[model samples]
Target: MFPTSRIPLMGGLSKMSSSLMANVVHTPSILNSRSTYILERARPLPRIYPRQRKRPYMNRSTYVYKVVQQPYDRLMRQQDLQVILVQYVEGLGKAGDIVTVNPNYAYNNLLLPKLAIYASPENLANASLYKKSAEEEAYSSKTSKTLMRLLPYHTIPVVLNQDNEWTIEPWHIKASARKVGIHVLNEASIQIPGPPIRGPDQSLHGKDFIAIFKVNNKETIKMRCKIFIWATKPAERNSIENQFWCFKGEPVHPEEKDDLDLLPIEQFNPDKIIIPSGDLENTIVCAS
Candidate 1:
């Protein structure tokens, strides 16, 4: 027969289990914030990726090169040099006067032009012959006043330098003036306002630019000098007129009377497109 105690214990367990299961409402566990956070922290984190930029599309065979050119520093970088002047340099000294300057300036502006000699023992010995130029006499002469009035009206022709470069230097300008019968005794006196002219600018074939004549570094005269390009073939390009038409008694080109683009208008081709004085709207409508 089954044991009476075992049977009672089994019946009690069944009653307790049935009661616990009957009409039971299941609910989620209430947790403290720290514990909840810990549970959330235990979960595997989602992966994050960095923002990527797409490279520009190009052909695999394509190549690009960045060209870097040296910066231009007026070429005034040489050490100070002592030079004996053989002619008058306005800011510096007169003939036979020894002065110190940038070696670049001394070479390019003075020594090369035969305006000054290097102060070697041989040169110093012959320095006695380097008499001061009669600059006062030259300037005070009767023709100087006329020259001042006429210089601005004259066209200054520039040429391709010995180096085959188009960059016009002060010495180049001085030589050009000498060739054209204009006497510019000193390169130091020729002052261009901006970065040196590098041309024959096709569009600006005949143009006037301002030049400052610093006389004795005391008086400054602003003159409008016309720039003319000199080339081997005259037939290739039109020659710029040697003089402007503004001065009274100067002949004006009747053909260029209507042109306002280039001054001294005489140098350029005449404006041939004459606009008929009829209504422009009607003309355009008719053409359309």
Candidate 2:
């Protein structure tokens, strides 16, 4: 007595129920346990870390220090430097920059600080001394140069007479001057010409001459003179012996005698002599 619609409801219901159970219960125990373990391990640990203690920076003072108060004395005692202590009204009191005494300490704490001003006694003393010395040296150098330029000539001439009475003639006086550095330039002696001669028959005849002196090949100054000797016999122009030599008598080599290159011979004439204003004390005569 089986029913006409009997298509095995039990089998179909059992398959449907099994499919529903498979779809509804999807949680995996192994996967869930692994995720739970990872989460537990990832949680922050409460570990103890020791705190590091930082060393405090030592504060330094800004002040200059030296072995002795007097910089010059201290410097003298030292082997190297020679210091001069000088006083200055300006910059009396200032602070010295803080400097490091040790390099092993942290550089931030050990290096010099920018809080210092110029306060070193040595530095101030050096500045003052240098200033004074510089001024004095400048003034002295200027004066020396001026004096050197002013004194162009140094020697004068004095004539010798028969009785040795010195008679300084204008020509001799003018020719006496010598340049300051080396020998006199363009030096010439004016010759004293012998007076006119009376002929054997007692006729009036004269020969007046001018002495010509030359430096190297160039002619220097000339001396005009007339001398009266036996019957007014004229003498050849040779009066340099009578003229005083400006230089002290020294035996000089012939080659060295002409080595002094001086001004030309034509410059000593009276026409070109122009005395500067208030410079008569330093008058220079020329060569002719």
Candidate 3:
């Protein structure tokens, strides 16, 4: 015969014990050899990695280098420029003359204006022919000598008709000679003793001056001419005495003292005096 209370107590103890064993079986053991083997066999927990730094992005198309090439012939043409004149260019040469000039100058001033052509053999030949012809027709020494002889004896008169004060220039002397059947082509051929004649010191009126001419650029061939300024219309005066003031190496007159005082010291030469005759005495002469 089982006791009724002892039966219930035994049932409850069995239930509790079963629950405790289940819990013990589920828990991991630190000291157990089986647990240690399983842990060694399993893959290590996925390594926790610090976040990686992002790299900066760049577009390769944004950076680019380009090189430009110039043609070789274009550079060469600018350095070496040769041209020939089809027509006469003063200070350069006569027609058909070959010359070297800047490319821009040749194109704009010569080629564009049809004044010159490119240097060629045919143009050179023509230039040579022209030079030969010009030399043959050039003024001869005999003619130049004859002109030179006449220059010393003759006087060229320049008349300044303008009422206002005017300065005497080399051109004026040339023009005066031209009027008197003498042609002076080159300005350098005429030589003045002093600077260009200007007022109120050196006037263009009522004065007798001398100019030297270099005949045909020859050192030995020189001519001296008397240049007289006729402030008023020239009168009929054959002798130099009538045309100009005559001072025969005499003392300055009381009336002329005022004029002499007014004259520049450089112009007043005490030793020199204007003679009444055709011969110029004690005159200062300069030659170039």
Candidate 4:
């Protein structure tokens, strides 16, 4: 058939072809294995999220403050005063007398200047002693004794004006007594039988009314007084009783004259007397 040299050449070519086919198959398998190993070794990327910002919380019951304004002049004028005293001040009073004064004036003019001091217990006791001495001196005087004796004999005349009805108060008696050189210190010393004496009644007017005076609540002195109520014009003298002329020889009215002395004791009538209803038991009528 074929030639021996050509056969050997074909055999070498076939061997080369087979070797190349083997290399091509092995390369595809190696590439597939590498891709799988890389995929298994790698890790996934971490998740990313936006950050949230926080807000402050508000409360409902918070307190709010309001300021009030006042005027400067008004504040200055509202200064509170304090009470203090020391030695006698000309316009104020005697030593140990207590007084009220402005705080600023007291501190600056009195305390700091050494013009005065606070009224303490010791100073007040001294003042009481002085008051007692003055009272004792006044009681021992001649004027005081004369006033005491005169209370029994004196007849205080309370003249009623155009208004025939007059209210006789204890002070009215005191003021009337003062006009006649008598000084009544305590109003409680004078005693009236009824409520205040109110009258135009003929039984009370121009009649002897009794007033009791209790001196120091010990001695009881009886005073006989007359209340004269006459019209603006002169009236008949016979309209009044004989006792109206007891104090003076003549009547209060110029047209009238003293016609009689006090009535006789036997002729005294309890019905005609104007004594207080309460004093009916103690009252006694005596002719002078």
Top candidate when judged by TM-score against the true structure: 1
Global lDDT scores for all candidate models: 0.50, 0.29, 0.48, 0.48
If scored against the real structure, what TM-score would every candidate get?
0.32, 0.18, 0.30, 0.31
Clashing pairs in 4: none
* Candidate 4: regions farther than 4 A off: 1-150, 162-164, 194-196, 216-218, 230-288
Per residue, candidate 3 scores C-alpha lDDT tens digits across 196-221 of 55543323334445566776666333
Clash pairs detected, candidate 2: 190-223, 193-225, 193-227, 195-227, 196-206, 220-288, 221-288, 268-286, 268-287
Q: Is candidate 1 or 2 superior in TM-score? A: 1
Please give the ranking of all candidate structures by lDDT, highest first, separated by commas: 1, 3, 4, 2
Question: What is the full ranking by TM-score, best candidate first?
Answer: 1, 4, 3, 2
Clashes found in each candidate (C-alpha, N, C closer than 3 A): 0, 9, 0, 0
Show pairs that collide, candidate 3: none
lDDT of 4: 0.48
